[model samples]
Target: MKDHETLGERLAEQGISRRAFLKFCTALASLMALPPERAAAMANALARSQRPSVIWLSFQECTGCTESLTRSYTPTLESLIFDMISLDYHHTLQAASGFAAEKSREDAMKNFYGKYLLVVDGSIPINGGGVYSTIAGRTNLDLLQETAKGAAAIIAVGTCSSFGGIPNARPNPTGAVAVSDIVRDKPIVNISGCPPIPAVITGVLAHYLTFGTLPDLDDLNRPRSYYGTTIHDRCYRRPFYDQGKFAKTFDDEGARNGWCLFELGCKGPTTHNACATTKWNGGTSFPIESGHGCLGCSEPHFWDAGGFYTPLSAPVVNIEAATLGAAIAGAGVAVAMSSLDRNKIRRAQQAHEKLTVKEL
Candidate 1:
């Protein structure tokens, strides 16, 4: 319903109404943690400037990353994907295939060389000389490396691509490795999670589109604006934990009262992510808020740190038969105390004992 132009100019020409554009700006402002005025400026910038080109690469991973993007219903990511920017390559979403798909990627890479955003959603397995995955007869590793050669910035979309997800877990028979492992020279912004929140994914993209750079990131390469604080810090049950009130079991009265889940092995204290705040399905609710403990899904090595049912710090339980002889070291001292108590029942003995002790 609007004429085409640079993203900046488009915002300027937003003939629909200020209500819609202002709403979009408000979303951007909240995500960026910027003031309203700043958000307005960001909106103007996006509406006036040319939309950036994004090339999404799907490698050895499930389509969960794409699924997350599709779940972004507000503003309808379909609108953003189709109207906001030029999505030149996406194997799952694109209608073209075979040589047409490969050429589409190649053409876009050449046309927008060194200026397009590269989004990857899976890790590259370097086993057997990186031949595990091949697209268009080229290995995913080779394709990633080659594509990175001219990309402006890289976005590692899912946990699989960001931190090797489950593929790179212990033993790692496939020898899976993240994008950062192979594409070391470029600037990478990692959005790590099995399926990262839709808002988070779009927020980062919108921030880059508005500001022309990556969003502020934490040490783990996740956007600090979203993942800076641990889930426990913002959790509703935090007060209960501080008060030492806890839920002993899943279906107990404590749970009914929405008491602290710490005793139930909540990992929110150590795990960092925006689940508590930016919840899935457009800020509905997170797992912990909905009668479930946090699984610490966003953290690296989440699958191996411990089990979902295991306590965050379970007490040591050693029940060998060898400790039976170690519990009776003070029997003689107990008998001596009993003898002294019996002697104290005699008044003359009590007084005499006190006098003798004093003289000694």
Candidate 2:
């Protein structure tokens, strides 16, 4: 693809219809929670805009983020959108290697200085002079520092890069640190997930390509559009949680009946991500849909949070009894539970008063 060619021209050359392109933009707009009318504007802007150069650097990660983005189920639309970017360097996907590959990266940095997007996956280890991870005899720390200087913005594309992920877990030997920890000067957007949803990654790119600015981010620097709501809030099993029907074991009756997985160690309540709604495998299903609870892989330090099978907190009441009561009286039981708690406090106060009177 010629660097000068607009996305529209490139798509046309590839025989991609404008209607399909518009559809993709509409999907992206919906994903980003943009107005319906904005889809057309986004499509137009993207079609006319120059493909921004992207330098993807992988460090202390499992490459799952790259896998998620490149191996998307909707390979046609998603890959096409991916191709819209002038990816100057990505060791995982690029064919060039050794000096040739290094030269390409250097050339892109020089040519698109202060304009190219820097996409980093994985944490950078700082221990032992950052020797834990290196490429081309240069430490990841050094490479990140060098590359970040001229980047227009940086997209930290996984939990590792965003928040130091598993590499920064307890007793970290590598002293892994997030990209934001090192590159403080540049604008950074954390796409924090074990491997962020493919559409989300692309949607961010689309937003940048269309508006020339990053989307509004949450406190964690994650795009609020995707990370604003907790997974439990959007999970289909939420009704089960509210009703107190929980699966005690993976193969329990409740489990088969699609009860809440909270008891089985789902971290949906505290984990903020779009996985519940966005699903995976081309919107087919996410982990919860397959019977396993959310591992809360999107959040920071998830690996060290607790045992994957351990409940976030032990249930205050027996799941079976609460489920039965809820099933019998619905919201009334909830109200009664609240009243009972107040009654218990009132009894305790009365007992305290009696003891004080006796003492007096």
Q: State the C-alpha lDDT per candidate.
A: 0.75, 0.82
Q: For candidate 2, write residues 1-360 as lDDT tens digits.
A: 577468888888889888998888887788778998898998899889888899999999999999998755432444544556888899898889999999989999999999999999999999999999999999999999999999999999999999999999878999999999998899999998998898788878888988999999876798988987667767898889889899999998999999999888787766778998888888999999999998878876567664577666522333334446755886688776555434433433343333234433
Candidate that scores best on lDDT: 2
Q: Any runs in candidate 2 off by more than 4 Å, and if so which?
A: 73-82, 314-360
- Tell me how many clashing residue pairs each candidate has: 11, 0
* lDDT, residue 327, model 1: 35
Per-residue lDDT of candidate 1, residues 1-360 (tens digit): 333347645545555565677787787788666777786687677776667778899998889999988998544677577557778889899999999999988988998899888999988999987788889998998899899998999999888898887888777887899999998899999888778877888888888878888988766788878876667767888778777788999999999999988777676766667888888887788888898888666776655554565455422111111122233444565565344323322322233233234433
TM-score of 2: 0.85
